[model samples]
Target: MADSQRTSEPTNFVHQDEIWKAHVKVEKDLAKVWPNKWGFLTETYKEYERESLKLKEEARMKLPHHLAARPPTPPEKNIHVSRSPSVPQTTQAFIGWRSAHSHLQLEKYGTVHHGRRSFLKELGWPLDACS
Candidate 1:
């Protein structure tokens, strides 16, 4: 079944983090919209609160001892994102840090592939791979 297949997919850690971050965002939005005729608490908000707490508890237990001892910190701001000035401002395209790093690798290594061995092999500039 489609449902079963969807559930079988492994949950990504980043996706989980995003879900937790969304819960906090929802709470903030609720607070800001409270007491306004147009802004009312919805059933979705209640569901988010319940789910977030359950996920948090599970995560805490799974955390390493040192991390568990310290209070959890808020999600980090996305500072690693790179902006491409060559593209037109009106167009929407996000060039991440990985893309920029890949560009640097290409320039330095000349068509070097990704991975540990390939990276180090490229560093042997004057000598080619022997045997």
Candidate 2:
């Protein structure tokens, strides 16, 4: 009977109301323990941010007059221009290349033998009776 029960498919032992009651109880317990748990963490983060901003302001004030007066220059944008004209330019050709790449990747890595059963089989465990 114990072995049969172990092998059988699991059934819903707890009803909807029971699950709801349990959830509500857990929430109530959490509220009792620490109602402002998330609020405390947020307040701590805000304090840290305030300190960081204050430090940044102090650093800016300490900078040399010439460096502080000068306007910040925009970063240069890196534009990539493909030199090869024979490379796939059309959408269809690009898609075909992508598909081929994916197929090659699958061929290199994909395998059928996997999961817990496979692992057990590799370790010389007889899983035929269990299944």
Candidate 3:
């Protein structure tokens, strides 16, 4: 896909602009790693990717157009997630724009009820649904 076209496309409805934003975030994060061997997000990052793929799959099958603009279909309740080294899982934490629940873990301490929201807000997630 052309760079411009790719930028214009939505990964899905619920997550439209993140694919590119994440790349930029990583590039900036990597610059701070200072020659570290494991600079990239490892298990959590991989899990994020896998989860993103799953969402994409579901979108293609259940809601293609919705995927392009699908708001989170939360399970009618707030959920708290614990972090894991394995595949990333999602949390119902609605912190802010910096968060991507598609495949992320909870805070290490789990102190915050909505870690995703805080993390995302720090990352610049919009304040809209992030209460």
Candidate 4:
């Protein structure tokens, strides 16, 4: 009766048992090593942070003259006047140019559906719905 019941079970049941056993073994192995690995990674990351901050401080100290000599520039009086009118003109021209260029490209290369239809034809696939 047990033999008959085992034989009645799907082949995948046996495969699933093997897969589950392998998964359990892997989990057990990871559990054994995980704490040591986690400790090593944490220590290494902390060391890296300390070294990086030390190097940044050294670089900053070496550049004291460069940092002090460059005074911050005062804002220009005509900055707002210069930006207000030219910005809109420049933006409008750019938009117009981009629109015309994309239209030209669409006419030259066709759309994504056309490309897919050509690819399917190359693969000798049926295009009943594609048309």
In order, how many clashes per candidate? 0, 0, 13, 0
**Local distance difference test values of all predictions, in order:** 0.67, 0.70, 0.66, 0.71
TM-score-based ranking: 4, 2, 1, 3
How many clashing pairs does model 2 include?
0
| TM-score on alpha carbons, each prediction | 0.23, 0.34, 0.19, 0.36
lDDT of candidate 3 over 70-98, digit per residue (tens): 67779746766556443434553434323
Question: Candidate 1, residues 33-128: lDDT per residue as tens digits?
Answer: 785744446666888899999999999889988765666565565334344336434434444433555643336456657664654456865444
- Global lDDT of model 4: 0.71
lDDT of 2 by residue, 21-129 (tens): 9999999999887846666887789999999999999999899887767655555445333333345878778765644554334354665665635766778877774
Better of 1 and 3 by TM-score: 1
Model 2 gets an lDDT of: 0.70
Off by over 4 Å in 2: 1-10, 13-20, 31-33, 36-41, 65-131
lDDT of 4 by residue, 40-106 (tens): 8888899999999999998877886756567656677433322122323466576645335443333
Specify the poorest-scoring 10-residue window by lDDT in model 4: 78-87
